[model samples]
Structures are given as structure tokens and as C-alpha cells.
Target: MIPPKGKPLSDFPSLPPGFRFGTSTAAYQIEGAATEDGRGPSIWDEFCARPGTIADGSSGAVAADHYHRYAEDVALLKGLGAHGYRLSVAWPRVQPAGEGTPNPKGLDFYDRLLDALVEAGIEPMVTLYHWDLPQALEERGGWLDRATAERFAEYAGHVAARLGDRVAHWVPVNEPNVTALLGYALTAMAPARGLSFDALPAVHHQLLGHGLTVQSLRASGAASIGTATNHTPVWPASDDPADHEAAAFYDLLWNRLVADPILLGAYPDGFAELMPGPVADDLKIIASPLDFYGANYYNPTAIQAPGKPSAPATATAAGHVEVPSDLPFQFAPMTGHPRTDFGWPVVPEGLYELIMQLRERYPSMPPLYITEQGCAYNTPPDADGVVDDSARVAYYDAHLREVARAIADGADVRAYYAWSLLDNFEWAEGLTQRFGLVWTDYETLRRTPKRSYHWFAELIAAQRA
Candidate 1:
């Protein structure tokens, strides 16, 4: 690797062949214009309105304005040499009230998007939902109600009937586990704003919705379908029995909770024993035949075994994993190392180990995709209207090398899509957090790719060469 003028470029390694490279953006994150073109209010729209919901006090009400500037974004995708583009279709935008006849306006937006991908020689990998549940659905109990799952299937069908003609790659639901846990179980950063609820219903219903949607898409002649799940490595704090047991519990909740049921046709041993009620029947639907499995991995959690000389742990500011005081395993916060703007620990090695575990655990699982892996950094602007964003550049450099290392060790990895194409309205944190290659002036929504974008393009050129 060539070192730059004054500083050394990251010493991270390069990628392997047949490993795809792409960029990802969600519907709610980018495609703003909340109430435009007859689009209805998403749960995010309502969430952003609630006091203290978003950090920057801004809503996707008029985000990157991708709805208006998507042409430029697609052109940006082509310029970046993206092999594929992973984007989500807004549930609210497409189905308006989340029921009945589809909204022609919402479908039209995707119609142009898919067309743009085809024209640009980029594969359009679509995510059906990325946490932007229509407010209309929430008004009817959202995922908590089994009817929401049926509605998802119906909505999926409407989408497939239109875009399915050209778009082959499909991810039924992006991080349903997170959608349930964050939206329902933990806190309301999303739809059905609530905390610590009977989320099992939402969980099962979401998975069932995936199965039903996959079936619908499959029937529509769509060739590819999968789901993106977020996983974290749980490390035991010590050898003490308390620590080991606590680590196991955390593992059941964070890592295995979703994959075990879908890939193994059952939850982890202790997990099923802990579930709320008789929802075993839903597993049948959740365990649909997926074409691939996309996992969104960031950092691993250290278990910090109890009753031993406890090692220092890093606390996630996002409060991603909830550890109770009485619980044996407390989140050992990772610190010291340079962190992203979001304060997530910057550890690439965790990603390497994560892939190995997936290989060991679910050998029968489908081909894996690094669904979402990118960091938010303090994206500062330069004099020439550009953001140097070197922190983000390093994050991707290290992570990509880990990705390459995993592929060398025999993981059926197909692709890597950066977390975003452009920074838009970050939920909860709102516009304060920037997790994108392209920087957008919130007011003007002018897209400007940071240094990372150039670095990625150079890497792609080198990868191809």
C-alpha cells in the first residue's frame, strides 16, 4: 500500500476475487420528502416529531432529499464503481396507509431507482424494510399485531408486482431482530414507540412476515432473497461460573437469538425455555429457505466473567445491549482505541472472528453477505467544499481487510455494502451523526463524497486490475 504525502495510508490488506463491493442506503435514511408525492407519514416521521426523539432535532421530513436528487445519487453510485447497490423500499411511501391499494407515487420512485441501477450496470439489491414502518401500521399495533405481518406480506406483494420485473436481489426485512428489539423490546427509536414489551409477538410476526414475503417474491419470479441480521460477539469476563453463565445468556440474546431460529429451525437451547409463550409455530415460517444470509457486524462484547479480576470493558453509548445490574454478564465497554463519531469501538479483528464463528455455528446457512458495516466519524468540511473524513477512510480500510481475511479462510462471502451512500437523517441521533460516504448539507442536501469515497473507488479500480 502506498503511503500518502505526509501520513501513511492505512496498512490494511486488500480484497479477494469474486468478493463483491457495493454501497447501501435505507429508505428512511436517504429518500426524504416525508409528505411529498402523496407519501404518508412513517413511524420515523412521528418519532422525530416527539420531543427528544432526534439528537439534531431534525426529521427525514426533508433529508438528503434523495427523492429529488436520486438521479445524482445513482450517478454517484456508478462513479464509485459499485457492483451492487443495497437499498430499502420505504414501507410507508409505498403503501401510504400501510394497507389497501398501493400508492402509485411511492412505487414510481422505486421504478425510476431500479431503472437507474440497470442503466448504470449496477445490481439493485433491495431491502424491503429498514425500520421505517408506516405510522399507519403503528396505529394498528404495528408488529405487535399479527395482522402487521400479513400487511407486510401484502405490501411486499405490491412491491414485487411492480419492481420485481427487473430487480432480482431482495432482502425481505433488514434486521428484524433489531427492528423488534430496538423498536419494541428496548426503546422507541422507531415504530410502536415502547420499551421492554412482550416483543416475542413482534419477533415471531416479523419473521413470519419474512417467510410470507419471500414466498410472494419467489412466486413473482424474483431470483434472490435474503435477510440482514446484526450480530455481536459476546466474550466472557472470567472463568467463574457466574461469568460463563452470564455470557451464555448474552449470547442467546445478541448473537444466536435470530439466526438459531431461522437457520437451525429452533432457538438456542436455553432461549426457547425463556420465551414468553407458545410461539413455536412461528419458527416454521421464520426458517424460510433464504438464498443468502446478510449479517451486519460491528463490535464484539466482552463478557467480563464475574468473581474474577475483572478486565475493563467499554460501554456502548448507544446502549445497544442492555445489561441489568443483577445479570451475571455486564457489557465490558471497549475504550481507548479511536472510535467512530457514534462512539462505537473501532475493532476490525472482531469482524474477522465474527465470520469464523458464523462458519462454525451454521454450516448449512446460505452464502453470507456483509450487509452493513460502516462507521460515523466527525465529518469535517474542507476549504474546497469536500470532507477529508480520514477517520472514516481508516475504518473502511481496516474493516475491508478483515473482510478479505475472512474470505481467504473459507467463508462463502459474496458482497460488502458500505452502510450508506450519503448521510441523511440519522434516527434518534438525527442529523447529528454522519455515517455516510457522501456528506449532505442538511439544508441544501447537496451530496459530496468524502475522501473515503475516493479511496473506495481507488480500491475498486485496484481490485479489478
Candidate 2:
């Protein structure tokens, strides 16, 4: 049964047996030992240091301080009744220079974190790279250079050989599409290059890196390995042919460009011709088989032709910037939808459309898992140190219902990991956006469970009941 909005989760349908529930976090966002334990600077470190780069003029220097207080953080996950935790290993921490000898101290920190998670009965799924490229590598052209891919393979071999015994599930990279577009093309994120389509090389190299990492992980006997790619359904602003044409192109660029190479072993239609270095040979590497496919979904995008005027709308609750006018397509706000605190439209049903489309499009599609899904609500704790975020709770309920509906429709989805477990430093946005079940006090680094946390815990327990 579908649980009505604002009601208890008791009426919600249970996920299938062995369906995993978890929370995800990136290292640079939470682990704030930025300079400790021989950890080198990342591109993020350099990006955050620049004036006027981050929205709040802040950096993740301290973040949630998870590096020193990971045990406390794990307790939060344990209390939430989560079966898994998807976390990223900072590349700069693992290989301070992005090459050469490994950092013993860096590896030791994760060793302790994994031990703690295992003790708490939480499965750890590790993501090798999550946009925090070592600054040393950026100085040598970063992802733009093909050598970075080779270096990434070497680093992956080292990490897999050491942690593969404990970590069965591996994610080679997280959202390379975001890294390429936001960071390189738009300069909206770290390693702010703003090179536009000139950054296409980054896309090819990152995927090559992912493929190489997968091969390295397999060599180390890793069980399940996949990469997380962010996706959103594209909608025309109206039924006009111009809007339709724009949406089609945007869809190819945003969704198909990333998924096609991974799932179908070729670029969308003609995009491969545009990519540099290799047009065919690398496609073989990029199309390596996966145990499961990971997707990060937020909402559908409404696109209009470049010359068409965008619809007048209030700012999004999710704080996504107004779509740039210089783009080939314009973005219009989704009408008649609830908005998250960051001004993002709440469209739980979009998740259903996205996954069903994937099942329809790819014959070789593997079991699906949501690597990241969450809404940012900057709600503060009350005087009693409690955050009552009923909206976030309702958001999860509505979205999970869509997930269940998709599964019933034969999507083969096996797991769902919330975007984050705690409020940490959101890249570029600094710490302003809080997309966490647990409210984190930036000053004290104290974690207080929000109402959503209790709701999710009860839902997880019910799934097992």
C-alpha cells in the first residue's frame, strides 16, 4: 500500500528480502582531516581557497570532522538501522601526489573506519574517486590528460589490493558527468576550468579511468563493482517543435552521453566522433560489464530552445542556479510541484520514469541501485537540539514508493542509498545546503538525528519485519 503523505510508514510496502538500505557520503565533504595524516591537497582544496568560489566563502577545512569523529558518525548510521554505507576514499589521501607510493596513514584511517562499520554490522561500499582529484595531478593537466587515466589505474590497483579483501562492492568513480560539465565546462564547481566542450577530453578520460579501475578491482577479486552516474529526465518546456528538438539534444548530451558508453559500449549516435584521443578502442574499455548499474537521480529538467524565453518562476528550493542563458537550451521550472528547501522541485515520480526508461532502452541493463537520492533542507535544530524535518521524511516516502512501483514494473532495482547520512560541506555551496538525515552542528560537529532519521529507521526495520 502507498503511505499517504505525513502518515507513519506502517502502511508503506516493504522492500524485497535482501534489498539493501543505506546512506552515502563523499570523503572530502565529511572527512575534514584535510591536511592531517600526510594527506595532500585536492583540486577542491585549491578551489575552495579561491575568493568568491564557494557560495558562503567557506571551505571544507573542518567539514563534519568525520576524520576524528567517525565512530560517532557510524553510531548514527547504526542507530538508523542501515545495512550498508556508501563512502568514498579521497584520492589525495590514498596517493598524496596521485601517483607513486601509497600513504600508510591514509590507508590506516579507512582501515579503522571499515573495522568500525563491520563491528556495527554495516556493509561498506567504497567509491574510489568522487571529484576530489589530487591538486598535484591537476597541475599536470588532471583528467584532461590521458596519463591521468593510467595513473588512476595504478592507484586503483594499490587500493584494491589492500582493501579488496574487506570491501566487496566497489564504485570506481562517482558522477563523472557532473565533474566534466559543472567543474570543467561551466566552472560551477572545483577545478573550475570553464573550457566548455573543450572539456570533452575529461569525460573520455574519466570513463577510461573507471574502466581501468574496474579491471584492477576484478584482478584483486572484488565482487561487485560499478560507477555512479547522475541522470535526470529531460522535458520540453512546451509541446512546440523547437522545445522538443532542444530537449532531445539536451537529453542526448546529459543522459545518453554518459550512460550509452557504459551500458551499450558506444557513444550516443555521433558523440564519439566529438570525443578526443580514441573514438573506438576506449569504447571497449568503457563498456566493461558490471554487477549492477548505479544512478543518482534528483528531478526532471525542463528544457526550451536557446532563443526561446524561459518561463518566469520562483527560485528552486534546492538552490540550483538559474540555468545559464548561453546554453544551447534554456531551463524552465517545473510547474505545480513542491519544492525542497534548496529550491529543487520535488518530483518523486521522476525516479519511476527514469528507471523504467533505462529498462526499456538497454537490453544489457544490469540490476539497478540508487547510489544517491536526497533533498537539501537547511532546517535547524530546535532549542532541544532536535530537527523536525517532516518534509524530508515525506520526500523519502514518496520517492521510495516510486522505487517500489518501478520494481513491481520489473526494473530489477536492488538497493537505495540516500545521498548522505549527515549534513556536511556541500561543494561550491559550502555548508549552506543540508541534505542529511542527521543535522550536524558545524561548530561542535555534534550530530542530531532529524525526524527523517527516525522515519527511515522505522521503515528499514519494517522491511525486515
Candidate 3:
């Protein structure tokens, strides 16, 4: 049974000894200063410029200003008692055009951030790419072109060589499935292409790039390497056979399409034939062994066969990507559960189910890391400046308990990183979705730690004790 909401942290099961806890943030989401210090424009920069793309019509130009305020952010992490901090290196910032000479300023910025993290006794996990492709590469066909994968490998090598020694863990890519599905197929994210099923090449190219990146980081003597893939449990809307088939297909596309290549070294049936380039040879590179696997879990999805006349309109109204009428499946709402501000269901047990399913599917899978898991709640400070975000605190409480339950059942879970440390630019949705433990005033640039932050700090202290 799922644990009751808002249970005291002390009531939750103890996490395994040596388990690590941290917070996560992507570069473009937090490190504003889009044009500062030789940082080249990323596809997101162009995507946001287009009218009607972002809900709030805002860009990450000055997003939390982490580029100029790394010291302060580090202190926030330190105060939160985070054992690790997962951050992404902006590719455009490192190699402005996604190729050619490295940017010293970009490397130096991470250099200083790492120094601060090291001084604060926080291990750093650096993700090489988080969907911020340099506009130059997007103009060259981006992930759809195999050449872009080659460019990604080169860029990975440069960043790994520069900061690999300082980073405790390296994640080559963040949510490739989302990158391919939303950005290319659905046109819901940056570099929105709306290519539909033709976007399969982007998926193959991303996996190939991930494989090459693992090789690059290893060559640079990186310590630990993994990936952050968003995973969800696919539930059929009903017991109908058609619904089951549609859910299975959605699962293959959203979960196994990404996992099978990395964990098993072979695409699921029907996928290899659709991919670009030499498939058999590429599988070998795509299946490189990893030190761990990062699972970014939020909520499970309910799917049904297409042709529900109201499905498309209902999903679009709820801020979901519109299900193309031609697609085999459509998303059905998972009713009877609490939802976050972003409209994601609060199903803590889904995390446990996902881990067990993965374990059963891949016997040789690597250790697991709960890489990115948090909710979005608009909890601004009150008159006294206290941010009472009890819902977020309850979200974390329930989710962490689920992780413990998974661990008890012999899942090799290692670490857990909250989705974000500070509220910053949420891509596509813009600044509207706040998923941070600390609230950020976009106008004043001031941060006020919410109630969840204090609760998390206490939970960490209890775990250590």
C-alpha cells in the first residue's frame, strides 16, 4: 500500500547505509547569462524567441544567474547537507558552436563551481549534455543527422578532459527519450521539429552519442559514468486488449526504446529496422557497460487505443503533448490521485514498481540512482517570508519511503537527487512551474528556502545520524 501523505520523515524506513542524497539542476535552467563570457546561443535560445513557444514568453537569458552566483548556490547546497550535486555543463557554453576550439571561460566557470563544491564537501555529478544543443548544430540537422552524434562525442571528450578529475560521477545525456519524443516528434520542446514517427533517427543517434560519450569519458579517466533517463510505468486505461497493446507500444517507445539499447545492447523488435545507419555495429557502442543507471521518475502514464475523440482535446488542455491522431496510442488520465502543480499524478508506488520491472527485465542491469525526482508547486513566500510548501515535503516523504521499500526488496539503489535546488527557468513551461526547494524571485533574483528545504535538511541529518 502507498504510504499516507505528509507522514513524518522519522516514520519512513531508514535508507541503506552509504546511500547518497543530492539535488539536480540543468545548466540552461539555472545558469542564465546566455551571452556572457563567450557562451554561444543554444537551440533553446532560438526556440524561446519564437512567439507562442514558451507559456510565459520568457527565456533563460538571466535565469537564476548561476553563472555569476555559483558561490551562493554552492552555499545553499552546503547548507542543505547535500552529499552530491548533479549539474549539467552547457555544450554551447563549452564549445560555442558545438565544434572547434574550446571556450576557456566556459571551462573556467565550471572550474570555479567545482572548487566551491569541493570546498563545501559536496561531490559533483556532471551531466555533459542536457538538451541545450548549440544552434549551429541544430542548423546542421541536430540529432537527426549522424554527424551531430560525432560532434557530441568530440564535445564530451573536451569537457571530460577538462573537469573529469573533479567530477565524482558523469552523466553523458539527460532524458534522451524526452529529447527525441518531445523535441523532435511532438514539437513540445526546444528545437521543435514536429517530425512525428520520422523522429526515430533522433533516438538512435542519441543512443549512439551516449555510447560514444561513455568511451570519451573513460578515455579521460572519469571515475563513474551513467545516464539519466526519464522512466514511467505504462498502465492501460482499461482491461481491453487494444488498450494493453497501445500501452505496450507506448512503453516500448518511452521506456524500453532507450533502456534496451544501453542495458541489453539490442533494440526491441521492430526498432532496429527503423533506425538509421549500420545498426548491428552501432549496438555494440550503444551497450557500453555503466557504473550505474539514473532513473528520473515522476509519475506513471495511462494509455489507451487512439480514436477517443475527446482524448486529444483533454490532454492538450492539461498541458500534455497532443497525441497525434495517426499514432497508435493516446494518453489517458490516471484519475483518483493527487497531482502536482504540473498536473503529474502523485504515485510513489510507481517508483517501486518501475524498479522491480527493470530488475526483472534486465538481470545484469547496473546499480540504480534516483537521479531526478520532485514536484512543481507554486509556494511563494508569505508576509513573514516563510514559504510553506507542505505538499512538496509530503511528496518527498512518500517517494523516499518507496525507494527504501525498493531497497528492502533487493533493488540495488545507490543515490537520490532532488529535481532542483532553486526554482529557475523550467523549459517550454517557462518560469511558471516551480520545482525548487528554494524559491526564486525572477524580478529581484532573491532566493527564499521553502518549508520543504528545511524538512529535507532535517531528513538528511536524521539519515546520517
lDDT string for model 1 (293-376, tens) is 889877777675544444343433232344334435566555555666676777888888988899999999899999888888
Better of 1 and 3 by lDDT: 3
Q: Residues 1-465, candidate 3: write the lDDT tens digits.
A: 233337876676888899999999999999999998999999999999999998899989998999988998999999999999999999999999999989999999999999899999999999988989999999999999999989999999888788877899999989999999889998888789999999999999999999999988888887699999999999999999999999999999999999999999999998899999999999999999999999999888899998753344332211357767888999886788888888878889999999999889988999999899998999788999999998998899988888999999999999999988999888988899999999999998988889999999999999999
The estimated TM-scores of all candidates read 0.91, 0.96, 0.97
Measured over all alpha carbons after superposition, the RMSD of each candidate to the real structure, in angstroms, is 3.2, 2.1, 1.8
Runs in model 1 with CA error above 4 Å? 1-16, 192-197, 238-240, 270-280, 304-329
Between candidates 2 and 3, which one is better according to lDDT? 3
Relative to the unseen true structure, what is the C-alpha lDDT of residue 159 in candidate 2, on a scale of 0 to 100? Answer: 82
- Show model 3 residue runs off by greater than 4 Å: 1-5, 309-319
lDDT of each: 0.78, 0.87, 0.90
Taking the tens digit of each residue's C-alpha lDDT, what string does model 2 give over 61-164? 89999999999999999999999999999999999999999999999999999999999999999999998999999999999999999999999998877777
Provide the lowest-lDDT 10-residue window in model 3: 309-318
Pairs clashing within candidate 2: 316-343, 317-341, 317-342, 317-343, 317-344, 318-342, 318-343, 318-344, 319-342
TM-score: model 2 vs. ground truth: 0.96
Choose 2 or 3, whichever is better by TM-score. Answer: 3
lDDT of 3: 0.90
lDDT of 1: 0.78
